[model samples]
Target: MSVSLPSALIGPLLVFVLLDGFIQGSVVSLLPVIRDTLHTGTGPAMWITATQFLSAAVSVPVFGRLGDLHGHRRILRVALGTVTVGCLLCALAPTLGVFLAGRVLLGPLSATLPLSVGLVRDRLDTAASRRGVSLLVAALILGATAGTATAGPLASVAGGGRTVLWCLAVLAAVGLVLALTPRISETVRLASGRMDWTGAVLLGLGLTLLLGSAAQGAAHGWHSPPVLAGLLLAPVALGLWVRSSLRSSEPLVDVRAMAGRAIAPAFACGFAAGVVVLGGQGVTVAFLDAVPEEAGYGFGLPQWQIGLWIAVPALISFLTAGASAAVGRRLGYRAMLTAGFLLMAAGFGVEIVGYAVMATWYAGHLLAGVGIGLAVSGLPTVITEGSPRDRAASATAVYYNLKTAGGSIAGAAAAALFSGLLTRSTHQPSLAAYLLLWGACGVLALVSAALIRLTPRT
Candidate 1:
């Protein structure tokens, strides 16, 4: 059966995907600049990044479930609208508090990715669905890469942080319009499921506390009362939420889904990928900022140039991810994942080597980007294939939430490493941090490969 979509539909969908990714990438990539402008310390800067993830972690599950109950199209439009508002708040934010608020609002908007995926699945026939999914994933990679690459240039051209926010706002508006125009069918509708308000609250608070503690602990010292309290409270809250979920007839997250063999490994791989992608991104930006002009180590590129540099990998990743989707179709999902991990591992290895030879840094970034593109492209397929039909959206949400949380953890860890390693005599760390981080990426890829091998072929 042929599934035909209006020519207009494709452009809108693509725009929506691009804008969503662009916002996320831009925010993370521009953090260094934001920190400089705001005069915020490393701890606070980490919070800016961590808060976005924390918000998404809490909101994705809730919104995804709600999306299932209501309509995905409705939720997507609302989410995109929220993104516009958030971008505006960010642009106008006079203080750090206001900016954090904007980030908090942007959390629910992360639903853009899954909602976009669901739209394609619901609206398109099998063949079109495959193509749509491929394009969707490509847009995601592109947005992320573009956001990183363009942020510096955009900020520079726009005249400051405020200008970047305005640009995001305009893009978000375009996404909102696209989301509103087409009425995509909502395929998955649960017959009866009460919103687990208590579960939602508990989960949100628990994640915030836990993630906040992790991000802040290194900066403030883990022993600090605020950090300790957050850490201690998180597990307790999580335990309570789990108990609540198990008892509730309609749990917010179906814990059983998480326990499935196929699903569990998918989540693990997504989490690992998040750590590497975000950690590598954070390190790249920081490395650019810290490298000295006098030493051969630094490019001494302006913010705009640096942004472009950051973007190059993302662009490469976006293109390669599309290629990966084709490979997945030909090679099977499991093979696709394994191949992606291997590529990523190779990329990280290249980075490790390049860091030693400063001249080769650009090549290392390109390799890393290719690896990220490949690995990320396969994750959605893995999650979908692994999930039970009944709980697919929730399962997808869980995988995503874990990935975002893992990325936040990586950002924090990297920040701590960079700060601790700062020395008067030596401008850059002994390259040990970069080596360890890259090594960790390689290990994660290998582990993902093993897991992919262990899962029974579909």
Candidate 2:
């Protein structure tokens, strides 16, 4: 477990992870161009991203469990190959259906991080594992920032969105090649039976229905038939899955492990982070772009300028996350986590109070970025460390899935808030809505800090 790996051994994983983040970020910026090129309506075009999230919701845990059963390296390589093919299909697809198939293939991209974490934890010593996980998190954040910042420019230079997709495909292929190389070591595999297919299917089905419902409800109304049906059936599937898992000797995911002190609290942190940070991103951009005169309060910035504002905080986050492990080492992870949440609360408080001031807003974002970096990077380590050695990836997967669920829930709530509190003339969310959201986020952050503080040390 303490063995040192050659950079070559781990390099491929970093590339795969960074590329995954890049693709996720870049696609959002290029949605407009992609839509026009494919001649798709707004609703269908949006599925390009939604499909991936749905896919990830299912794939993350499945892949994690598979990696635990087989080897992390084996599963990671398979995932890379799948995503590579997905990229190629997307690049060349002539129709929306084909593109979505490709996107479905691309879902495994999100699993790369957890897989890599498991691999490093299995191969590296404790200190090294902590550092490695932190680095991967930083790489992800960095890649996303770079991708989002450059996607528009890259498309302009390349002449078409397809060209950008092609470039992404090529990068994915390179990562796959690296994964195929013999130099990379395989992780320690489980000593037990085959993966529990029934549990996987039930869990996947349940999560898909639940996430799909949230997504559809956010887009269309919550009362839509599909959403209603999904809401009604998701619980049944999930309940059955839970019952089966408890009964099985070797469930796909050991549900019992989830109740442990370290994992449960870490998961709570991830969920809170998703709700307070990840979920509000769209509204943040909207806030930046809203016309001040019409909306009564907004910066009235152009899209490019809004990206810059976002980039500043992201850059800070990248730096902070990269250093978070070392800080945790010095300060103790519990204390670090507590501080992280406090910083986020302070950030949200600043943003809420100084809504009209640009400098104050930027400072608030920076504070929140630092907090997010610490929490995001540290939470995974906590989960992995506390997990059964063989189940590290599975534990991380649960944390991720829960985080995504939180984001979906928050997104739905935000949409409802904006719609219900629309400014009469502009038909935009009232400034009061943003204030209320931030206030809620701030309160939640404070609550999370207390919870982390109260959580029993592993």
Candidate 3:
């Protein structure tokens, strides 16, 4: 398990992950544009993102199974191709509905991270694999920063959001080429059994219902029939999905394995990170973008400048990710996870001060960037610790799926907050919403730190 890979062998894969991260970050940059272009309200704007998370939540696991059943390299190609097509749809769409449909297509590409993790494990020796994974993880995190940073400037210079989408399409196409560049031999893990189609549908529908309720509740009164029904149906649907998973010959998630010590905590951390960090991303931008100059409350920066601001955390995280594995080696994953949460908490606390000093803002974001880098680096290693080599992709899928779902839930909550508070501030989430978000994220980061401590050492 310790073969060193040629840079040529690894470079394309790293570039691909960076592209994925960039695509991920760029989507946030595009959210405000997409919302404005579609003429949707603030509450509805979040659906553009929430829907992606909900859809990706279900699709990631399914792709993981396909990767296991067939091959990681083959499935990755399918993911890259699907993203290229999805980018095409988004770039050309004439209306909000079409754009959302395009967002659904983009969900399948989420499997790339887990799939690539599997590829690294299969193709490299143990020591080399560890280095590759660390590099890949850093690239994924760094690309997001680089993309977010670059996109704001791109938007400022490119003249429009649609052009940004076109840029994304070209990026996806490049990723497709890189995926094709590697003559990697496909590694098939699971050699038998059919897919859990029933499980996938139930899980997807259930999550959609629950997340939909949070979103719809903001637009319609919480007492509205559709919202009410969604609230009532979500748990029942999810419960059934769980039951089906437990009884199925080939469950989408292995209940026993998931319940195991190391894996369970990793999933928990992923979910927490989703709500507190990933989910907060959109709101963070809104806080900077929506606050009017007259309001005298926010930085009053332009959209692209706000993007550069947002990218600060990502840049710091990117720089810190290189050291994450080494830090974990020196201080144990438990310590790394704990430290990450604390840094995030500190960052949130710094933001909550809402001081006029722009430097204060950058400092908070930079702290968070480093914290997030550490957690992202450690969480996956923990999840995959005792997993079978063949099952690595699927196992990682479980973590990613929950993380996506957590982000969806947090976004729904933010949308609801925006709906109620928007009357006070027409452009952005109200000041109240911003305070609540940072406060919640801070508390949750503290909680996550505690939980990581309880994860039994492998």
Q: Order candidates by lDDT, high to low.
A: 2, 3, 1
Q: What overall lDDT goes with each candidate model?
A: 0.74, 0.86, 0.77
Candidate 2: stretches off by over 4 Å: 1-6, 189-191
Residue 385, candidate 3: how far off, in angstroms? Answer: 1.5
User: Candidate 2 residues 1-458, lDDT tens each?
Assistant: 23344586567767877887898888888898889878899999988988998999889998998998899999999999999999999999999999999999999999999898888888878887888888889989999998998988889888879899998899889989888888778886562667888998999999999988887886888888989999999999999999999999888888887766667778888899889776655578988888888888888999889989899889888898888878888887888889999999999899888889988976887898899889888889988898888888888888888888888788878888888898788787899999999888889999989888766553
Error of 2 at 369 (Å): 0.6
Candidate 3 per-residue lDDT over residues 68-132, each given as its tens digit: 77888888899989989989999998888888888888987778888888877777766566666
Q: Which regions of candidate 1 fall more than 4 Å away from where they truly are?
A: 1-11, 29-46, 125-127, 186-191, 288-305, 358-364, 422-424
How would you encode candidate 1's per-residue C-alpha lDDT over 54-109 as one tens digit per residue? 88888888877776666667878788888788888888887788899999889876
Q: Give the TM-score of candidate 3.
A: 0.88
Error of 3 at 6 (Å): 4.1
Candidate 3 residue pairs that clash = 1-125, 1-126, 2-125, 2-126, 3-125
- The residue-level lDDT of candidate 1 at 346 comes to 76
